[model samples]
Target: MKRMRGLLVLTILCFLISSVTSLQAWEILQQSGFSQALGDIFFIDEQKGWATGYQGVIIHTQDGGKTWSQQKVELPCDSELYNIYFADDKHGWVTGSYVMGDGFILNTSNGGETWKIFKTKDMEMPYSISFIDNKKGWVCGFGNGTILHTEDGGKTWDVLYKPEKNYLWRQIFFENAQKGWVIGCESPQKGKFFDTIMATKDGGKTWQVKYYKPVADEDWWYPWSSIWFVNEQEGWATICKKEATLLYTKDGGETWTKHQFNLGSWLYSVKFINQKEGFISGNLADSGKGALFHTKDGGISWELTAEFSKSLRKIHFLNSQEGWVTRSNGYFYHTINGGKDWECQLEPKTHLHDICFVDRNNGWAFGKYERGGGLILHSEDGGRNWDKQRLELPSGDWQMGIHFMDSQHGWTGVSILGPNSTGAFLQTKDGSKNWSITEIEYLPQDIHFSDAQNGLMIAEIEGGPLVMSFVQTNDGGESWQVRNKVARDKELGGRRIPSRIQCLNAQQWWVMSSWCLSYTSNNGKNWTQKKVPDTSGFYFLDDQIGWFGSNRLYHTKNGCQDYKEQELPMPIEWISDIYFKDSQEGWCLGNRYYVGDSLERCIIFHTTNGGETWEVDLKSPQHLHRFGYASGRLWAVGDNSVVYGIATQAVSALGKQYITLGKVKTVLFQNYPNPFNPETWIPYQIAQDSDVTITIHNIKGETIRTLQPGRQRAGAYILKKQAVYWDGKDDKGEEVASGVYFYTLRTSDFSTSRKMVIFK
Candidate 1:
């Protein structure tokens, strides 16, 4: 029996270990490769391929379009790889720009197991390559049809020919060693619809331009993007149509005819599987919205197949049935049934700001700035086009907030805290005009003015007993009033307090402090206090509902009457901020320190059922962080200025459980164990800290208590200051307050809460 039991226990342990291992896999919906700005893709088979892009990025796939992995390459950081050519599954070569030099090529012999670099003698960059076998190949770039021939599997190269000054050849192909053709743009810069095609009758010893059509005046600058040959007699070249035109030739380069493939964007690439079926891809203007056009009758007519929001930088085909297209965004799209269908492969992001999409059509992206500054950009279209815009700050001051009700009526808040610090309130009534800077009667930190008239400002003051106040205005920043006064030294043996005010309506407002949640119904007058959970992150949805998150959750219902604890998934020991769109959606954020003792991750949790159950959104588990919601998006900013945002509507059902996202509220609770003890407990709440003060006083109205004499953030506070621990004595150390005493909590918005206590 003992032996049997031992075997059963061992089997159980194995099963448990297997179960735990399976659960450890982190599964996301999808993942892409690092965004190296992909430039080319080549397939050896339908299921196996190689891709190349910027910064020497090479990705290989073995299972068709299902999975891909990065291939290692040793190239200088300054190199920009342009084209990849694979002879087999393991043997391949890539041509790219050099490290502070001209063009160089790299080749692998043992199925991409290793690579060798071959520097070519050319100032013009090598952009195109064709191989007859492992030992014979041709490349062209940066010249009027200058071709290089490589022997001994690309170990050495010899220049074949350098064409004239104004001609730029891009593609070269040969039929046997005796006949070949080269295609590129011609000179004179006008009326050149047909590209210059040269014929070499003697293995490329010499070349003659057999056919040249002058480029039209409208299409003078851009090159003839690509060319393909089925054999010696049949060929096709993709030419940018000053009109919607795709051209084909039947009898070598002697004659050309326009193939009808109408498109709004320019076609840059063309490939024919046979005579009847072919595919083409290119950009729509400069935007990434390129499309694949397929023709059934030898380029006679075409139809759109696949469209992309990223630029179709290059395309490669293993056969008529399978091909791949790469984009500038470092993504590879592969199609098995020709260009009829496509699947994408993602790339890693080299910089924090690599992809910028405005709508979907217009966007701008750059690889890297050599001078160590911002290299990425913005756009106006839906990510289809891009233009480089200078990164300049608006003239007047750094814009703190941008509020546009429509397009014309907009408001911005600016701070004059620079070296030219002036208390100026700048306004722009027109969409474009000189900004109106006015000095107001307030040294405020935050401003939330409604319309052009009614406004609320929070100010912190220092002096005597009172420390903070809220001043308001109703006449377009002309006059101000001391709506409320938040004084220190009134409650809990005269503990100092800090407070902040967030106006929900005009009359209903919320104040945040280190200790409690304080609510006001009539402007900032009469306040009520309710204790919060801990001393950190809290969010309010409105005047009645809010969420407090620290290690746990403390929720309030019915205005601010009560506080209750709610369970969370894990212990969020560093919650920093909370936001809610309504009563059902909310988010809480903080950081968790990793095992490396660094804040390598962010801890973001969302709740759907009003803080009942929480789901982890981000888990950096790193340093300190803060999050807030403006408009319909929640923005989280962190240590390195790492910003993250997600739409409020995109939140999952689990995310909606958090009802507190944006609004701020405050509450303060009375001290516990008022009767007698060496230690007592005092707690308070604040949504935000303008300035907060808590103080205790005797019946004679003499000040004896002070707590938190400065500003504080939203969350609960526990006061255990030894000074507030009276030896059952009054401010004079004598036993007092056996009847009743008073305490007050004050905020920077000039909102205060008072509580009465009795001593034994």
Candidate 2:
């Protein structure tokens, strides 16, 4: 189960990063106009604004918040994004942290169209970012008490202060480049806790404690959750102690006035358009009530503007009249009347997670609609507008895994609900305009297609933990059966899911969990295990050679049977994912610890001459995730819900012809594990849409089984450590004997033959 957590975290990181990755100047594509939960909202002007949330989510609206378009951010999609700040509609920055002890402060100069990452030096997750102008900003968070200052529009940042104690700085507001107020909390001992507000005059080079307040009655837990400052002299902070408390500061933090709320309310977000007006919202978790407070007279007193049952977490205002508050229920309340009245907006029916542009005008985004059916949003006008295309899922499911073989062929792995629920595998052949779904017993975390007939899928088995079933389909989704049950330990527990699966063709494969790697030479029919401390990312050139990433990169020969470790140019905590175009060229992405804080920094390295030498590709440590080789491009997906691709030929000339083919041709490769151990993989590809078929024949020419008989475009291999092999079984699921056999691939215009020997 711990192995499952690897991909589980990857999936979450994928989603978390999805929302923000696309923000590189946002182009939002929602599901029936609904996206996932929104975390923070910011307005650049009365008409231009941005909102961010789960999955690296950032939405931009140019039309006074009436319609929002999602943007594609080009950062690793694994960070927990929190706040949005735009110096202008063209220049903006967003801040967040990663689960892996790292944080992000991304900047955009061209209306969110492109971004440059100003990575935090310390591993502390930045919670709040404030830019006084286009060139000066401040960011602060907990973990060694980080408070960062930037002078050149985030081109570089200077650590003003990182406290010795492990205090969590939540929010930082800079009235000017030099005058700033930072708010956070700390715990010195078990029961002793206090909240603090600080002031910095030397551009964060020096910080002084301005005010400290203790939560009375031994609670020691009065921490401010949100902070806002209209100017240096006027600021407000919301508290989450025993009850929701609103704290106001005037005269440049010389004094503060506390206004207590109902004992059950926990006010979170505080936003003020000006010194005279502001609003706050929070959830009364104790009573299942949602509360909103409004103050027109600069926080001297407050009025209950609205109430609901859901807990509110964040609030934003575009002027005092045009404001929105996000809640725990994945919905938001809007007020055009200065909080005198409010209107609620439900969650969108379709919430997209990923978007890929084949070209400027052709692209596809994925998400789920309200009914829980996976959907594709296709754009033909350079992402200016999108049209939703609903998928016909097998059991009315939503997408958990999605991949496109091309603009035409794609797959979506979906999860079904209810007692009669089974997993769903969805396919799109018409460029995402339509879909066909198949019901399966497993829920795939990742899917791959070596070709149409032979492929693999790694999935979490239904019903239990650490109990994953591996399956293969020789007939391409017609039927699936267990190839192996990877029960690492019967006594093991938790959510350890498979993080990565690398196949060096069909004969050998590698599956990496969080802490271990399983290798198979017989197409996943048998396996060998090596326990690794942080085996999160890996890549294999063949059965005999591979690299596993942890604090350091390790190399294994003789098919991972044994390995030796190598010291990288710098230390890494764990690799998120790894990729290789060939044996000689590859890329490694992983995290390294920030100097003193447990917070982490992401690192990227590329090797051109196998593992003999390496060089850093990234300027410095920044959060990055899974990578791939597609269309002569090295593609990387990260925090920005954005997919970044670099020309493959530029970095590695060998990758110019990465896929070995003289020209465009359709050929069937020989079955993997050809000598066979009861099962082997047969892979074939098609250049165009065609009726494809695969048939197995005995030594005497008698038909054993027809693996495939259908029209095909392209297919997915097991993105994990599984594959579709014959398994020496007949059409009726009967086991066959040992012998040499032939497999024929037949299409409307092409035919090929391969031989395999199956031993039973």
Candidate 3:
């Protein structure tokens, strides 16, 4: 009888695992949204252009920058694409680097419908690409001032020059097949560096230094950023120094003159439509505001034609009347009338830090601009369209905490600059259309309001020992009173500042930090400290039911009298936020840090058994900060303007299948020992007898193998012995290359897919 009970328990555990892996994946509601910082842009004409930037993103436009579409590159999606060049309408090239210190070049011959990738092992980080024609081009970057030449349309490349160690080539331009120029900077010793412009006359067989800037103090050095030539004799270059400097050459490459602008700007790119009309793009040093300067008298006198919230990276012009400028914070502008008017091509000029939704159709996102100011964005139709809210704020002010009781009652904490920069709270009673500022003596880190007349704030008081105080307001934030203060533990020798706060009502409050957890039941008249396990996040459904998350999850049901530890399937480094709709359903955002790699990939974990077990619902490259639930959907917002939403009903439906409602249906589990070297196992389960098959495909969606496992009986095939196996080979018995691959399971009426990685 004991053995029979053991078998039943094992069967139930297998069913739980199977059902947990079958949950619906989260979908991105809004991303990119022109929020990727663009590095370079190129236009073959006024109608067709391409821009490359962060995250290996390549966007193309066919309607004169009015609309854009993403293009796939045959490399890691996280690689950094820097420079793009098109020799004509049909052929083009892009250069970028991976975070793991490897440079790559992408070429397209059919107008970017597809791309072919070539790895440059010798060039650690290629920054610039210049092609005089389709067949001959040169690339320069930071492999000890490396210059590479490609004579056969980038199929192969030959090293042309590697001047010295600690040299970084920034930009390259070629006027013809034999005459080319490379601008870069080099550090001869430890403390100082200088800039140089080198000219190659024999298609990169040899080079001569045409101009060299002497090394200045270690505190200051002018580095060349970009160079452009309208004709053989008229050319221009930009130097990114404390003050913007322009280098001009009228007599070919023999003689050059310098022009300086005392606007406290750092110029990046220079372009000239004719000898007399030119433009320079950069940003102000103090304010980080993107600025575009136009020169109408051959680089003699300049006027500020445009400015943006972020710095400008590159500027391109087909003519004086038609040009494009790319900002450093994922924005681009187009002008059709010689810089007199410009139209921005992207939306959301801020990096969202937190988001809240009172209902399914109404929400608000809080963030700060790249140039240092707070921003409030409101959406009326479930974040499909957002409009910026106008608020009169001090310069250099940013929001740190926000809470909204409903659509009409909201408050935000603003951190400003000046003497006594203690920050202030902006309270709104009529849906943020108007706000009243209430100055406070402490900086608010997090705030929660139970009603319009009662709220609690976790604030930081500046003085000594890093004090964190809980303040309360009973009259709608018109005034605040300190309730309790927690100071740093001098004996522990670690800063203990409150990171998150929750207010259940006027009498119940909870506050947590990395090293401590505390709660107050009667408006902070008394407090009790609960033992925590290096807490990273905390969530409470009520005073009795609460959870604390770190590498592991801890749950309490009796107001922290005792805690139960829940085992997660995989190891997590940290949990950023937690949200629970009820006692049985919850979600937590975590990050998994790999050994020897600096990148921390974010993951969303879902639980339906009241933290008894958890399953990964989503994986994202961007960091997610908070989670919200409204109208049967779960929402998350984080870095890079990412907003993701998933239907909670779908999750609940999947949860009910194996836990309560019925038997487990077809379910596909993620492969074990993911990022395998020689082999991996694919686990799955089936409810009834059916024909089962598994197909493997590469990242490009080309099928590599189709495994016919024949008919399988109803049961959980989740163990290693029962799972389907792949030997890391294609159907033709050839070992597959190391990269990302997808495996799909099809059984009768059900089909699903999951991703895996292979590293050799």
- Candidate number of the best lDDT: 3
| Ranked by lDDT, top first | 3, 2, 1
- Which pairs in model 3 have colliding backbones? none
Local distance difference test scores for all models: 0.55, 0.63, 0.73
Taking all chains together, each candidate's TM-score versus the true structure is 0.45, 0.49, 0.74
How well is each residue in 433-517 modelled by candidate 3, as lDDT tens digits? 6666666667777788877788888776744325767888898877788878876333221212236777778788888866668
RMSD of each: 27.2, 21.3, 15.4
Better of 1 and 2 by TM-score: 2
lDDT of 1 by residue, 1-760 (tens): 0011111010111001011111111111111134345667787776777777765667777877576678778875446777777766666778887433357888988766578888876634687777766777788775335688877778888887775544566677776666777777654222233467777877788888766676665664456467787778888887654454466788876677776554635677788777778778776543437777777887667777777865465777777777777665556776778777777654233222122222222222322221122222222322112232222222222212223222233333333333443333434344212234455433343455545677655544322223335666677555667676554333322322223345577777776554566677776667776666443457676777887645567788766577788765543334556777777767776543221212234557777888887776654422324443444544444432233445566654323343223332454544555423333555555556557776767657777756554765544443454212334345566554333355666776544444343422
Q: In model 1, which range of ten residues has the least summed lDDT?
A: 8-17
